[model samples]
Target: MGTSVGPSAGLSPKYQRLIQRTLRIERQPKLELQNERQQKKNTKSLVSDLDGKLSSLQSQLSTLTDTTSSPFDGRNASAAEGTEGFSVSADETASTGSYSLAVNRLASEDGRVSQTFDADKSNLSDFFTNNGAQTFSVDVSTPTDSNPDARTSIDVTVDSDGTNNKEVLSDIQSAIDSAFQSAVDDGTLSADQRPSASVINPTSGTARLSLRSQQTGYQGRLSFSDSSNNLLSELQVNADQIADDTQGGEITEVGTDEASSKLTSEFELNGLTFTRNSNEVTDAVDGVTMNLEEANGTASSFEVTADEEGAQSVVKNFVDRVNEVITFLNEKTNVNPENGERGELADDSTFRRLSRQLRTDATRPVEGQPEGLNTLADIGIEANRDGTLKLTDEDALRTAVRENQGALKDLFAGPDGVATRMKERVDQYADTGGLLDSRQDSIDSSIDRIDDRINGLDERLQRREQQLREQYAEVESTIRSLASQQQSISQRLF
Candidate 1:
């Protein structure tokens, strides 16, 4: 018998796979589209980064452009040692000057304490009718500039079954607090018009109830009377006790002058005497607040001046933001020196032009400014070699902020000022519907189109692959027919 060829002959499966892979590799359009998509994505990322930097720059610009309540208007109050009678603070509206203060009296809050009671032995229910529930009223008077005698009253009902004096006092204290707090919540009484109640056990055997005003000075004075029961008289904290105490009686009165009953803060500012209802006086001096701590009756010297450091901080922060935006633009638009590859935004004309314009805006001199305080260079901010800004001369900036504030304002906030012009330019590119947003939208659309094209290419590859498989199937059939014929011929010849 002669040897016969098998039907599984000709092209091997491994070679067929190699040929299909070669054909797929030659489809260059899909690979090119993928590369383009990556480039666009990088460009979009750079655009987002630049947009964030521009927004930060705009916020810093707004602080400089604001006409009212700016850092330029800041003021500071300074006092020497041994002037411990009062602490002072000045605002933007305060004038730069020296002030002399002498404190005669510091305002105080009104308070009252009941006579001591033997907690274990005393039966506080006797104040009521044989330990029955008793209802009494509390009157709080908070005087104000508009109303000298604003009084509010709240009635509290206490039910105590205990014979211990401390426990009964605690019940009364809780009732009083609950009543006033409820009045405050219902808008019947303001918070300052409410009084605080507490029961203090100074000794193990003795306990006393104390009530204090929420406010300082005479505005917080309090008085108690019996509403349905003689609670205040029995507690020995009524107006009669207060009067007798004020007239050299045993019950001591806190926060009230024995001679005049004038619970006010009396101090002399700038050699002129003035009195305020509260120790924290704000209106006595324009834009200056004086907080009285002691009644030393000694003069203290305080100086109010422009806040140079505050103004300098504002300027430095503005410069830092400007540098950030400028540096980002430069980096995104730069070209690599080694391989000559363009950066993410190298071809973006808007960002390229913005980079140059920012440098010009940051360095150019403002019109109508004086010789020494005209430009950013004059006020200590200078451009670096790469076009970023730096605060180089702090002393010059400080002098400009303190002595030449008007000219400095003109340099940063005027019509043709550096900060003003830079802000306008950045807004055109970063604001809503601005150039950067439009560019990003256009890039997104292009990416979407690329995705569609890639999908079409994938479908075309699949169809081509199917056609190649059919052609290879025909070749396999022909090989099988030849192998069967050879086997038949060998048998016939034999």
Candidate 2:
């Protein structure tokens, strides 16, 4: 029942060698696993970059295809040909301009006077009020026959102190000037637009500030009040009368042809008066009503409506967008960046083919049209010597757009449009079953296999490490037994 002494006292050299060999095997697999993991990471990164590039190219190609097939530029030949029967002249009604507006200032229920101008009828009170209460009031009006110089007065009263008063007045003046300038800038008003406001005083007082219209016939009155309905009433004299008295008509151009003509012409919108000779046209019998010049020719009878202008602008923008897309694609594929390299998709045969295809698709002829109307060239979009398209004849293009609008819309906007075709092509190359998709699939599969292999290697390495430890422990025990046996034999011999 007693425990016997073992011959092995310590680990033998043979057992140590066996343990070392097992450890070497275990470490070998771990090193291999590390290398495999690094390789996997590098491979994944490479695949990811490639995938991104592929996706980008696919998107670009899709966009190009869509644009190429889009109805934006595509027109039905028959529709284009039909447009030849109609003619549009720039001198026609399209060239004529007219605006109608009504302006008036009324005392609000609270005794605050509010002014409104134009069709939408914007209230000047909004510009000068807070919470629907006027903080200050301005009176710009021309005097009656009793006060010939009354038009020269514009009384501004500031209920608030500090820069707010000055700022508000300045803003009002600016707004008035801007309104007049806008008409001139848009070519709707002549340079002789008669009214111009002049600030008399910039400080707070009775008639603290005033604006005088440049013309004598411009006799309009305005009144200002605060939110509390308190009136800061002031009188303004006719500027012409004032000038005649002070400078003997030297500053007054009332009788001149320019002034007279300006006075006679008024802006009307939908039969409503908007402005007359640069002054807000009003219904009051006090002011003279001016007549517009009659159109001189039959062509002048035709009018270019807002809708027509909008359509023309839309077409132009579409063409510009197409040109931009073409330029972008060309630069990406053909031109090298400043760094002396092309895009990822550069030098790709597919991209080159796609570009050519897009061009071809864009320029393809439609059926059922006259020879001249078969291609974009008939409508004035001609191919340049450099292979790009340009609008050589704007009139022809416009006519085509007007006459064959439906056909043109179909060609570019229909299901078979250049944009649609381009999108299909790009999607084919970039989709799950596309060229890039196949490559990605292969790479993914390889990654999966590699991962599985690494996993197996990991498990094998762990098992081998554990086995080595166990073997080393056993070897140490055997050596201890051997040493004990040797010691007992030695003692017995002695």
Please list the C-alpha lDDT of all candidates, in the order they appear.
0.79, 0.43
For model 2, the superposed segments whose C-alpha errors exceed 4 Å read 1-47, 58-208, 211-234, 237-419, 428-460
Give me the displacement of residue 282 in model 2, in angstroms.
25
lDDT by residue (tens digit), candidate 2, 1-494: 11212332234567657766866766675577567666556544543554455466445434333433422232211112222212222211122233222222211111111111221222233443543323343333343569743422222333322234334444545645665566557764444432454333312331122444333232322222333443222112222222321121112233333223223333333454333333322342222222223322111111232233444555454445445545544655674656777654465675556557656755777554445555666666665543455767777667756666555544444466443554565566556777656655765677677678767876776666456556666667677799999999999999
Every model's TM-score: 0.82, 0.36
Which is the leading candidate under TM-score? 1
Where model 1 places Cα greater than 4 Å from the true spot, the runs are 1-11, 81-83, 114-137, 141-150, 156-175, 185-187, 190-193, 198-209, 224-236, 240-262, 336-341, 490-494
Question: Candidate 1: which pairs clash?
Answer: none
RMSD of each: 5.7, 16.4
Candidate closest to the true structure, highest lDDT = 1
